[model samples]
Target chain A: MNDEIVLFDYWRSSASYRVRIALESLGLPYRRISVDLLAGEQRAPEHRARNPQGLVPALMIDGQTLTQSLAIIEYLSETRPQARFLPADALGRQRVRTLSCAIAMEIHAVCNTGVINHVLEITGGGEEVRVGWMKKFIGDGLAAVEALLDNPATGTFCHGQAPTMADFCLVPQVYNAERWGVDIADLSRVRRIAETCRALPAFQAARPETVKPA
Target chain B: MNDEIVLFDYWRSSASYRVRIALESLGLPYRRISVDLLAGEQRAPEHRARNPQGLVPALMIDGQTLTQSLAIIEYLSETRPQARFLPADALGRQRVRTLSCAIAMEIHAVCNTGVINHVLEITGGGEEVRVGWMKKFIGDGLAAVEALLDNPATGTFCHGQAPTMADFCLVPQVYNAERWGVDIADLSRVRRIAETCRALPAFQAARPETVKPA
Candidate 1:
């Protein structure tokens, strides 16, 4: 539909999947414009103009382009107030942002495509070393998340029963962890939250495999 | 002073500086506990129990130990509403978080002390290469922040005249940029913000030199 939003993304970008989850949760209609990372399409002049960092999950909203999954999700949540992705209280909101950043900053950045490649090339390490590093970082991060979720503060979701921005970030990071063969079973809290999230049609529809390119 | 909160930090840790800025902006009283990074004091069993990640900027809040600068600042803002470090509205809040992430996730993660050392040891890249990467990454990120701040939406600070959590994160990252000898003058908006932040006693008190070890 002409009214549909356009998401510029790659199939396996955990960041893009975050936005996908948000869009689906809000039940907003959207179209996907695949940018092949393997082909280095993200570095093309046009894409660079959109996102100088040459990253994915850029969204074209109301004729303006927005980069950064957190920003895009925040925009969507703000514009669609009825679909709240954050808590109403300031502390609650910070908890969600803090949890999200734990993954985005500490875990995801370490295991990101560029960083992983850089490590592998520099250390003369094979896939095993890289995978080992990925597992350690993601596993540590998830363990923290598990503790946060196990707190009396946690409900059905990261914050409460409803999925907040934190959940949007968590699911995709877990997806990447799975791809790396990291065991999620040990992370009982994260596993429970992920399962609850996957059960939701919104989260299901936004999965990497559900996207057109896959 | 007995009732003063304690902040466990490293003099050079950008994450710790972020909390310092927030505390300064909010005019909160706290004592600093220095953990020497070069001395490997952060890995000490005592410190590890306070923070499993062995990271700095852990806050002792309301009898609970809190790690992560974003989380500490948010908790501070929440507990001290009058010192509101984030915007009241979701859109404004999202913009702040987005800017913060640009520094925390994109810039800080890439140039982290750990990553830089890894690059040196693994890539056999001399200090020149390591420092080059740091400058390039931080410089580019500051430029992005400059663009975000240039919008008429920006007031005296990153978000507005009154410093928010975003400004707290921005100032220290700028400090790190300066340490790298990057010509911050080129990024006018960032220079302006850093100048504005430094003028405040809160920020000054939170400077690395102001910490106990220094």
Candidate 2:
């Protein structure tokens, strides 16, 4: 019940990567507990005690455990407005949420390990098939996001001059999309935003390469 | 650019159902412009102009277009405080969001029509395979939700006295679950809340049955 912030996370996980960026961006000090998804450690009894959903990026703060990456990032955003994790106006907030959901709800969730593995088992598809499946959805998801980004509202980041929650979702998804061999050559707008976000120290330190287990 | 609220939605789309329930519960007068998903209306150029994501429950209000169901719902929860669409406290809001994301982010997003269709084409699977894929995720998702619902926080609904966004997601998913032949006979907690929400007039009118295309 201590007030110290702690994040249950896996380095390679887009969800975990998201919370890392949010925390790092907010300059919030939090401890990290790695839940190795490939090792099936997220299903551990102790982890289950923290998150009923058995998912990564469960943030513990204010003596309470919070699950779901977007929710956790949102908790950070609402609590730490100095970071401007979300925009100030309602319409701006709505736009940021829309963009965030485009990646979190539409893309990353669909391409989750559990869902892809389920697809593998149901179809008896091999690894190549699975990779192909990931690439197709990742490509389409980014395409939709790219179109949305093709607006005057879109600046160096997903929204305006400053990075927001939408950028937190965007950076990790772009990283993971490339890892899956999805061709992003056509997604000009997305690539520009990804480049902008990755340059910042907060985003750099949270990259999968930096946080990956030794 | 008008102040009138217009929802471009598709009946039988759980995402659309979630928004419909939100609008109905808030007693917001909005016009429905159905985007026939099965008929490929969402891909139409005009619809794409409104929502580059080509997804439904796109709300045009306050002279701006908003996409993503969860985002739209959160806007309603924020701006329409009289309905108490969300909890008052931060911790309470986090838990409510945790439950809401369990369904929106975990289950519904993974089992999206486009993703499922892609699975079918890539795996060379038929309708049975598709149904099986859905039931597995739906069952697991509900099980996770049930565990969350088991805590002392549970009242007559997913949050407390009034139905929140969690129930907004759960009811449509349950309706879709039943439609897809996913048995909920064992998911007692989820079924209980679904029943409670279904009995309400707001949820009743938003049921896919009422909104289904003739």
Candidate 3:
């Protein structure tokens, strides 16, 4: 198992983008295998075998196939403790996880491509409806993120002057929100964290524009 | 904080339900305050202060309020090592979190009541449409759960003979699936895990019927 680290992810997947940042932040090198989500490569039998949900960014590391971005990040942070991807105490860790999950569950998962497509199919609404649905969920979720950021525990990033799992989840969602044209200028706290994180080469290297498959 | 543990949750909120089972499994006693989601009580100013997300199952323990079911469980499992709610090693922990997240993110979060209501409003579909959507998402998500359970790592519970966080998540989603009338007979692996976990008094005590407010 010679320390194999392979990431099977789509270039534009916000979930995949999170893992890329983790890997780069930790300075771990790995091979990249693009799964062309828009082309339905994720639905192929081989990919389904890799991840039962057929979702992008499944990483094969240390002879194990790991699914779920947060879980994968946890594994990386645990295995590479120096990365400091999590907080030290239980309370700090809980706060970071809560922030990360607020975005992951409350927004990203709820407004994901699959769910949006389902909404469109059932409603027979086209792109306009899909964009509207995206705006509403993203807006409400970001507002909650702003509130969470107001806590004194927050610093230069989602936690105390360092990027943890919360920032990994937060940055990608912020990117998606901007892509949807949701104005985030009102979210000063969230904007500050995203801006601070984006300044890092690790985050910059993981951008969808930088990683997009040819 | 005098070892006080209070859970603010609604009877039928699956996110809240997961926390109840964790507390019970750990033999921790806590007072329950129902948030009355049906009456929009979760939106009250007080609840918002506790958890800005205004969601249920915010546990106040050790002088801090914790939101996000998974985060709370992680805190419990970390603080009380004796509870063993998670696996021992990094790989095992990742696997358990993956299974738990498959339900939390892939199904429960995606098919939430709010999301469903939004779908109805945008699609102009009524109860039938809502039910259809639930069945589809729940069924698909459960099928993935079933596949994840097929691994040799699974025991009577989601991880081993002893229950882990995976079981805590599985039981509630199973309850929700049944509530939505999604058939699970075909998912023997999932059914077996759910049945095994249900036999525990902790799971039984946390059922919506048992915990509903008077």
Candidate 4:
């Protein structure tokens, strides 16, 4: 049986980046297929066929195509228990899932391209407005995340000593926060965690700059 | 043992509504404490103490405070096998999670109050613009979700004969969609699923009007 895994991804998409981090951190080898979100490739019928949502980071593994970044991560965690993407206890797992969703569902979802473009369309705003929108949401959202991190469960990473799904979600979002020029100096825990995540080779290989199409 | 379960929620909140349906469907009784989102009560330090994210539907269950509607539902599913909020198989669970996140993370999250309010702040637009923004994002996001429903796996509910977390997420968003006047006449599958779900007491009892404070 062929075990080749393929990931349909865009270079800079947070969702796509999330899947990449999961794959890399799990030490899984996969082929990357670029779905150029910038050029409207994702909206094409072909890409939509891959993911009905027309979103990137659709993963093909174990003869099934998986959509949703968090779901994909969960699948990996469930299948590869050795990866330990989730904690062993139910409560710890809940905390990791909560922290992950706080960013993925709340912070990253609002700042998506479609919503930002709509803001530009309705407001007749320019690049500055777009950047402002990103900064406002990312900064405030990260503040809430920082508040969430002040818990006994939080360790060197968002959940515990080892990087779990929450860290994968966090690294991409922190990268995005920096990309939009949102100040994170006040978010001490967030900054420290992101810095710790960046030092890892797994996260380093999944960096947008490292994975961007040459 | 004080087995009393408490749910801190706001009526008309999509996230809170999702949790209410889950608890009701599972036959788990819980007390409701209103967090008036309109009054900015969610931002209060007390509420934030319950959920650092300061979001509605911070559930106090099993003597622990659980935040994030989807995560709470997952916790319930994990602790209660008979409830089956998720599927049994790995792939089925992945699909269910994908469908659930497609709405919760993509649609409901983007149309959240914080995001829409920011849209208003930037556009200098008022009621009409607010409604327009709601209609546009909710409309487009649901259409994508409708397209996603075209799958062999979909049955009476989002996954199989019984409702899963996907249905819980779908019903609330449809309620929000109708509330905002986003026409769904063409989304037959979504309409049919939501209609089927609404007829069930679990979903009907969780409706905003049903639980709205007098």
Residue-pair clashes per candidate: 0, 0, 0, 0
lDDT of 4 by residue, A14-46 (tens): 999888988998889999999987898989998
Quality of candidate 3 docking, DockQ: 0.89
User: If ranked by TM-score, best first, what sequence of candidates would result?
Assistant: 3, 4, 2, 1
lDDT of 2 by residue, B97-158 (tens): 88988999899998888878887887788988788888998988988988989888888999
lDDT of 4 by residue, B1-214 (tens): 5789999999999999999999999888899999999999999999999988878989998889999999999999998867889999999999999999999988888888888888888888899998998888788888988888898998998898999999999999999989989999999989999999999999988989999999
Which digits, one per residue and each the tens of the lDDT, describe model 2 over residues A1-214? 5879988999899989988998898888989888989998888889888888888978888878888888887787777766688888877888898999999988898988888888778777789977887788888999999999988889889999999999999999999888889999999989989998999999998999998889
**Which lDDT tens digits does candidate 3 get at residues B99-127?**
98899998999888778878888777799
Chain B TM-scores per candidate, in order, are 0.93, 0.97, 0.97, 0.98
Give the least accurate 10-residue stretch of model 2 chain A, judged by summed lDDT. A74-83
Q: Write the per-residue lDDT of candidate 1 for residues A58-88, one digit (tens) a residue.
A: 8877666677898788778778867798888
- Model 4 CAPRI quality: high
Question: In terms of TM-score, which candidate is strongest?
Answer: 3
Q: In candidate 2, which residue ranges exceed 4 Å CA deviation?
A: none
What is each predicted model's overall lDDT from 0 to 1?
0.80, 0.87, 0.90, 0.91
Q: Candidate order by lDDT, highest to lowest? A: 4, 3, 2, 1
Better of 1 and 2 by DockQ: 2
Ten-residue segment with the worst summed lDDT in candidate 4 chain B?
Answer: B114-123
